[model samples]
Target chain A: MMKTSKIPILKLYNNLLISIQWELDDKTAMQFQEDLLKKIHETGATGVVIDLTSVDVIDSFIAKILGDCVNMSKLMGATVVLTGIQPAVAITLIELGIELEDIHTALDLEKGLELLKELED
Target chain B: MSLKISGIVEFIRMHRDEIMKDWIDRFNKADAQSISAESDQIDQAIAAEYVNILIEWSKNKEDEFSRKIHEFSKRIVQLDWPMDKIAQCLHTFEKILFAKLLEKQIPGDPLELLSEIEKVTSPVNREVFLQYTSSYERTINLQKMALQELSAPLIPVFDSITVMPLIGTIDTDRAKRIMENLLKGVVKYRSEVVLIDITGVPVVDTMVAHHIIQAAEAVRLVGAKSLLVGIRPEIAQTIVNLGIDLSQITTKNTLQKGIEAALEMTNRKIVSMGERR
Candidate 1:
């Protein structure tokens, strides 16, 4: 089932790793949330790196959904790493009262992927 | 008989002289009434003069007290300056982000304004706000670090007697916030009876049920009672399976019934006082 999301999944190293390039807009946010959860379960992915640099607005609801996505993915024995969330976006999420401390983010998608690989190791 | 009359008049002179001396001494002291009788014109004049002086002195005393109060307030405002700063951190981040966005959407020297703010605010605040702007994780962590992040409201909105109905999912984090919000609201409103309608809540698990109870307890801590409404069958089953006691909190089947219970608890009859008219 195409679980209601347009986010691309890059299967690298012969399906050893998967990266979700989540180009989240205002409308596609909820879809990303549901689809990501489904993919995490279906792939039985070891680690998932979410590239969110394209997402401009980090509203409270989106921030919460991100955290919940992390929690849900962790429950399925997969680690979720977020990347490309600009420094400015992080600050806004903080102001919105969304605690992103436990949710790791990196400057670029590559670094985030590297970090996720490290977690896998 | 002549000598007796002369002696009697002499005794009267001595007593009058002594009384006059005493009144004069008292009149020299505090400006209050001399505590002497105003039987004659002279005594009446002295009493009136004392009353007039005390009137002027009383006005002076009042002015002095007013000045002292003003000074005390100024000192207090200056003394607890950090408390205000800390409280601002607890709340103003919302406005801060909004302002920054507005600045982005407008044309202005946000840097100059930020500098001005830095001058007025403490180093800690500047650091926190700066981090809130520059580093996302640090900002979020700083905000989350605050255990009691809620600020004391400058103005009391709802009297402790006001009611606020909460609806939706109640997670542990939300429960805490709800507890804080309810307590803050009850205190703000000075509300005696709180009607928490749960009709809008989609579902309630063990944690959710516990949170509702915690929120009720928090309300009571702030001197208010609560009536929880609209516990769905699924939620009830969850609660029973979890074996949590909500008996400490009063619950009703509907929002209407909860409001009625609140009225009853507050000893407010359901019929409006204007009904008699």
Candidate 2:
């Protein structure tokens, strides 16, 4: 059996914070998607902030999975905010033709939380 | 073969003064403006040095001949002598030297003398042109580097707001540079809003519009909003005429309005002190 490491999801107030600290493989990404949705469902969090400050090298498949995760969280009534995306990663994603439109983005975790608060109002 | 080579070398040495005088006269007639622009003494000195180098090279000072030719070409190029002027100088010298060779009887066949003269003169001509073009290419490369350095500069005008004023036409290479610099500046400055002022840009065709839209989209992905500013009246007309969908991006007619909107987006505005007083 291959050990699949799960991305930890922390709950704070009515929002869930996830910081991807390493490069995610396909299996790990899929697991993270399922785990995040489960956490959103269990906690009934109204906002989610996914921080990719430490993570690098997101391929097209990983980008698609992230987009799917954002949409899935939205379907469950949680607003998703992506934070701390590196410049290289942003350029790569743009070059790959994945705009990730309609997704909220912030400079850092503090800004991401502030954006979520603004949306709540 | 050795005797023939020495004979041609001896002939040039014997008539060296005559050759120098004739070359200078013909060169002055051919390029009078350039010659008179400088002092007559400097032109005479250069021509004298050129004839001396040819005489030395024919006498079998191969290494010194090449080094002197290299330095001579570099000096003339720096002096901004036109390539045609240099060619004309070489042609006049060759004609004078061959005429001297033909006028005086030598031990070798006429064809052999012609070929030997060709061997000596052709290399110098080729070397001069080679140096000229290489220097020209070097200048072009330097200017290109300078232009690239000046291409995309991102300035942080206010807190959390940056401005990138683009001048000149935006080609694919420059567009790619603009996008990279804009995105990198946003992250580095932690800007919430960016204003791209294209007032200096003369033309906005469909391709340029597409690049702008892509840059705006990339900025959005990087967590900053991009506002296209400095749209001239004609640019606005062309944008609509081309059917470019700039509706998705916020654009202002001038940079001043763009800055105001940027400040407003960042939840701050400049209030006049006179009104408060």
Candidate 3:
């Protein structure tokens, strides 16, 4: 069995920044979800920006988990902002007919933070 | 030996005018029934130059004759003459000249001289035919490029809002172009909302809907919202009948409503002034 490293969720100015730089296998994605929730609870952050700039492929299962994470975070009173979704990934998700309607998306990390700020305001 | 050929060449050259007049008369009579007015003018103007080139086709003037034929072929293509007519005219010129030489009894072997004449005019046919096909290929390529340019056009209508009005039938290749142009326009225009007006689109099938959905998602990914406008009653029915889910993306019945929605998204609105007070 190959070992998996945990996806780190960094804390920056009361918001969590998770820039996924590698492909997420099923196990790593689930682990990342759990760790993110734990970190959100520990820091009590109200906004989370998950950047998928480097992620190219996203299957339905991974997409479902990501959607669930947004809902879960919202339940905890934190607004989640998905940022830096590449063109190819957007096309793939659309082709798969997986529209994360409940989720808010931004062009990049900068815009994501601004969107979060706007929502807070 | 060469002097006899030159003498014969001079003899043929002396009767050039009579040969040209008869040939043109015959050629024009044969084609007058079918020739258009514009083409008749071109044929009249080009006949003199064509006769000159044919008359000068001999050992000393072979190079000049070839060059003239090249120019004549280019002109014929520009005039839009049929390929068969060009070859026929050249053969007619040869037959007329050969007959004239025999009637005049020029001092040379008629068979040998006929073979010599063949050498000159054969290139004329080959060159004209080559030029004809190349010109056709060029025209086709130019038209294809023009069609591609007219295919997809993204126009910015307002501040932070752009509209891409689509018309005609949608195919996969055109859809791909639409997607690329949408994403590029979104970033370039810094548009917060994009209204895709499909009033001119005739029919929308599952494939077209899928493409539009994909384009909308791509627009969303680029940080702009896409609002589909101009969904006719029949199109709506087709969507429902096909069981296609378009609920995720906001849609409107007309471009006006879509623009209004876009304005609202960008926190703006058009206010109608009461009157000049």
Candidate whose DockQ is highest: 2
Query: What is the per-residue lDDT of model 1 for residues B1-277, given as tens digits with 9 covering 90 to 100?
Result: 3233233233323343443444444433433443444423444343333223222322356566345434433433333323444344323432343354344453335564444333222323443344334445655778866633431111222232344445555566766565556655554455656767666678776777766665665444333467777777776777778798988788788767766666666456556567565
Off by over 4 Å in 1: A1-121, B1-161, B272-277
Interface RMSD of each: 17.3, 1.0, 2.0
Stronger candidate by TM-score (1 vs 3): 3
In CAPRI terms, where does candidate 1 land? incorrect
Candidate 2: clashing residue pairs, number: 0
- When sorted by DockQ, best at the front, the candidate numbers are 2, 3, 1
Runs in model 3 lying further than 4 Å from the true structure: A1-9, A18-46, A51-80, A86-103, A117-121, B1-22, B34-45, B51-69, B82-122, B237-245, B273-277
Candidate 2's displacement at residue B186, Å, is 0.8
In candidate 1, what fraction of native interface contacts survive? 0.00
Which number leads on TM-score? 2
**Model 3: pairs clashing at backbone N, Cα or C within 3 Å:** none
Per-residue lDDT of candidate 2, residues A29-121 (tens digit): 999999999999999999999999997688999999999999999999999999988877887888889989899999889999999999999
Rank order (by TM-score, best first): 2, 3, 1
- Alpha-carbon shift of residue B122 in model 3 (angstroms): 4.7
How many pairs of residues in model 1 come into backbone collision?
10
Which ten residues in a row are the worst by lDDT in model 3 chain B? Answer: B1-10
Worst lDDT run of 10 residues, candidate 2 chain B, spans B31-40
Query: In candidate 3, what are the lDDT values of residues A42-67, reduced to their tens digit?
Result: 99999999999799899999999999
